[model samples]
Target: MERLVQTIVQKRLLPLVLVALVFIAAKIIFALITIVAADEAYYWVWGENLALSYFDHPPLNAWLIGLTSIFFDNNVFAMRLPTFLTFAGTLYVYWLFACRLFPKAPERAFLLTTIGFLASPTLFAWTSIVYNDHLLIFLSLAATYAFADYFSAYSTDERTSTKPLYAGALLLGLAALSKYNAAFLGVSIAALVIAHPRLRTLLLRPHIFVAGLLCVLMLTPVLLWNIQHDFASFELHLVDRYDRPLFTSFKADTFIRYLASTFIYFGPVLMIPLVAIFFRQRDLDQFGNMTIWIARLMIAFTFVTFTALSTRGAVHWYWGAIAYALMLPFLPILLKNMWLYGVHIVLGLTFVVYATVNYSYAPVELLLGGQSSEVARVYGWPEAGELAVQLERKHGPIYLATTGYPTAAQLAHTLDRTDIYDLDPRPSHFSFVERKAIAPGADAVILHDQFGNLEGTAARFERFSKIETFVYTAHGVDINKFEFYLGEGFISDGDQ
Candidate 1:
């Protein structure tokens, strides 16, 4: 036993293994304890109605959820299992990236990168739930690793191979598919390559064309899906992204929230190193120095874009998580300084402790978001579904729906039913849910927020005579009330 233990210590496997195990355990515990979050449940609904892609984003998340739901039963743990494993994959790939980027102290590099990556409060907290960031982190690491190897080969005096460059492009394409935020990586890489004289020749390579074709092919499903849907998804995701109206009406509160949260999301343990690396620019023609430039470019683009966007809309800090991840491989450089290394270890462990304890308790979620707020998106929803089911049985053949997507999705999920639709005042994916609408002479139940505009919802179904209205109270909350209506010569279309 002593001999085996010594071998393990000598190999420096103990710390990396411990970090993986502890983080994996914390994620599993969180998934098991917490109810399904709103966005997660909302995505769960997307899985129920399988499509090539979804209206809100790409289809990788739905694909992952569908695969996970098959083996583990459609519950919180099952839904989140894929994301947890994705996080695990991210750590392993990042370690490889670290080893390649910094060979002198590979073990120390892996350990600190793990601390900087896994111990990040936002990144760690997100592992417990299903988010596209899981896919983003995984694919982004793959891209980073492949890009470094490719860059190394490109920078060498004798060019040995172009395989890594092709592989990097494929990974980057998939990264964009995972989440749109990764598109900025291309921007960063372009800026650095254009500035570096030796690397500028890459822009003229036929290999770049081959890789670009592969990316286009990988992204075909998303494009085709949009083509069939009149490119609504394209309009919503890509066009609307930059379509913020009236920048003159900027909100200080939005900018304040974004600025305050940006530092925390980048992982507090990494603050000093990220700052140090960003300000320092080395010879890009030199091997291994490219990642620092990439890291700086990523950080700069992410903070600036998100901060500008936040002025016109709400931006969550985790939106920049993948950008922060590009900097992790460079963190091992900080390990040479003993005091900073200690700070990284201390902060990493402290975050792990807090996050581990917090995920298991409902009360502590307040620090992240209140149980009812957007961040917590998990509360009283099952209860809402139970009430809907009870009411549905009373009104036989009645169409059941709500004005909002989340409420409609929760009801559909818990009832183990489908076509439980949402009444969107405008076009949305919920409108495409089976192309469903109330038939003529049908009595229907509509759920809406209690404090919300009832007349606004009732106006959508004006053809139906209002029969009864009552609140659906659950878990000591009087929100999500229901109103009964009887249709008069109902048409297939009114307001989508």
Candidate 2:
């Protein structure tokens, strides 16, 4: 087995091709078995609604989901096919960029980097879901690649064509359409142009401004939608989301949380060497290649910005995934010892096993005494959907609702009904999607999760029927408990 592994790693193309195929196959298998989470179901509903833009995000993911639905059913596997494709595309881009940055590195070093990325537990487990991040990461990486290729070519050959620059700009537009975070990509590009003397002269070229215009043109729909809806999306992302004043509350715990998340996202194997390299070099230019310098800037800017945000408030762990992903090219630095390579191979395989088990079995729920929101989101929804159907049948076309957007959206997808109302006052994409509001004194059924809003939901109705508690169990362990109530009469808030 050792000899066979060595032979595969030594081969020019075998390791990359073999690992990629296996990784893709695993994604397929995982997507097939894993149930859809609330956010995914919410996005799936966006596919059903077919909107220009949404309250929470741009329309690109909703558009992709709509396209996926045309070819396949609304099941988890079908909806997530686009994400799988994008993940593969991301890997391909990383391969090209890594090879370009490390021309002196051996084939084995490149292969090791590929294995490290595919086996990162965070990405391996998380990327299977259909999210705007998948599209954002892929397009942003592709755009970065195009810009890097253009710069590298232009530096060597003055007569290099501007096709790559244009392509990069077009992709950056798509990336922006994917998620709001792509603004960071634009910042990186602007910074790269300003810092690099050779590329600075391109400011005189007319094509650069044309490319920028083309990118801005793609955002017309987003701008139009925001105009139609009072720019709520921008307000939500920019102002409403940040409750705390920036840099006012710089907590050590939050900063540590962000740092730890960055480490885990890179995976244990690569994170160690990556930190060592950073500490040893302590300068971006030490990476030597201009292409690498761009990625390093991305890593520095993303981590530093998020680290500050983390000090202010809780930041999502995966927000820095793009930065961590860009560290793939640097993985070749770990190839100094054959023993390190062997250890990396073992660790990579181990991560794959860990992800497969974690996704399928969900041992974390057991460890946490069945209190994982991640587990709860995926399970109990189908049962809740069925209960909603039966309740509506008994109640005779009454309104269905839940305390939160996630539950409401999951119920909508499960029952194939878009009229489900979220009783919570908190705004979500459902706020924009048109549905018949429940009139005063109308009958309605509300579903509440384990998080519990029984009294709050009861206040919205004149009176409540007997509440039924339903617990969903998997493998002899209870996953989540939900309360189903048949309300006597619905009372809409003044705003509704």
Candidate 3:
């Protein structure tokens, strides 16, 4: 630990403390103010049943949120608290990895890497929200560190411990469970093992085999869930998200949109040059480490896969964000020129702009135009829930039903009712819950509007007793108009 204290005191301690404080402060502010986002709301409902896996994502994020719900109110903060803490862990792992990779000015190097992560528009912005990306980032960092240690060993006698190596495999499994993107880590692991002669010795060691077994064990839940659900989640990720099937979904217009979003999200000026630097130094063998090799594989995998998918539709920029930070330690070798600090400022400003758009309206709407309404989804959830409560007093514990999963989730959190669910036509997680809760002649209060598909929801009800539209407003602005349908005599299978 010759370098550990210097890195900790000079680079890690004060900034990390500030990071913690700011993180906590932001958590408090956002948690208290922002309503649940549509995806968050969707995952929030996933916590209600505590399944092995969800319709869209793996179960880790939902499990974390579900655990936190026991300790805090079922609000944004409670659901997102785990994400914030997980980011702190990622920051630490980044520092540790940097310290090992850059021995000369490990402190400064670590600080720069930390800034790289802290200034990421997608990573930083996501820490305040409950996204599976949050969990995957931390786990990805840890697994990256372990792989670097194992492969970058100074000698055969200095090989990495068996425990940490095995732990990396386990973490990767958990990461895959967090989001399917972690599967790309397999590319990194394979490249490391196959590229290096020493690492291939793992073929003889039972340690790697045990780790592989553990990884597959971790996937048991997702596999079982998919089997039960007609492999719906697997098919969704593989076929729907990744499989483009030649020229069908391919479009240059979509590819251009992907480039723009990726550039903006990764930092227009900051990341482009830095990525150049990393690849340049990597080419020259200036900073030869297994960590770089690991990150290189990851970046290549995500870039190639996402770029290919971009031909189909707009790409998700954050797909590479996790691997992006892992490679930042190599930037110092390439970035000795002036204006480096200026680039840092630019990255920070970019983060601020993204935060403003994500949380506020007027400015973002002006810039993003039609897409500005992304912020509107968070509105009216709590208010809609409140209104439902007041109406429940008159309706006498009426069943909660909403046209969209977003409304249903927010309402479920508000009413503390798992009975609250979406009424979409296709069988969803909501379909399973809503069916058991419904009884013949039972009164169901439906919050419906133009936003989501209500498809065949009306036919499930016999007749409507009361129908009215209410404008949901907040902060002196109207968010949306919702038509509340008090439908009595629900027609369940028992009626048939």
The best candidate in terms of lDDT = 2
Q: Give the TM-score of each candidate.
A: 0.85, 0.88, 0.85
lDDT of each: 0.68, 0.73, 0.69
lDDT over C-alpha atoms for residue 106 of model 3: 63
Residues 1-496, candidate 3, lDDT per residue (tens digit)? 7676665776546664455455446544654455567778778778878988977888999998889888988665677888768867876886786667676666676666655555656666666678788888889888877766665552254365677777788888989999988888976787768677767777777777788788888999999988888898877666766446745776788688887887877665455544664453543221245767777778878888888888876567877776776666665664555366457546665555556545644324534444445666555655667777777667877777876666677677666777775765555667545433366778878887666565566666778644666776544556666678887787775554
RMSD of each: 4.1, 3.8, 4.2
Best by TM-score: 2
lDDT, ranked from best to worst? 2, 3, 1
- Residue clash pairs of candidate 3: none
Off by more than 4 A, model 1: 1-4, 7-21, 238-247, 281-287, 335-361, 365-372, 375-377, 449-455, 463-496
Q: Each model's number of backbone clashes?
A: 0, 0, 0
In candidate 3, how many Å is residue 494 off? 11
Model 2 C-alpha lDDT per residue in residues 301-340, reported as the tens digit of each score: 8878887787766777777666666666666663356466
Which regions of candidate 3 are displaced past 4 Å? 1-33, 154-160, 241-246, 277-288, 313-315, 334-340, 353-371, 392-397, 432-437, 440-443, 459-466, 474-476, 487-496
Which whole-number lDDT from 0 to 100 does residue 374 have in model 3? 60
Clashes of 3: 0
User: Worst lDDT window (10 residues) for model 1?
Assistant: 368-377
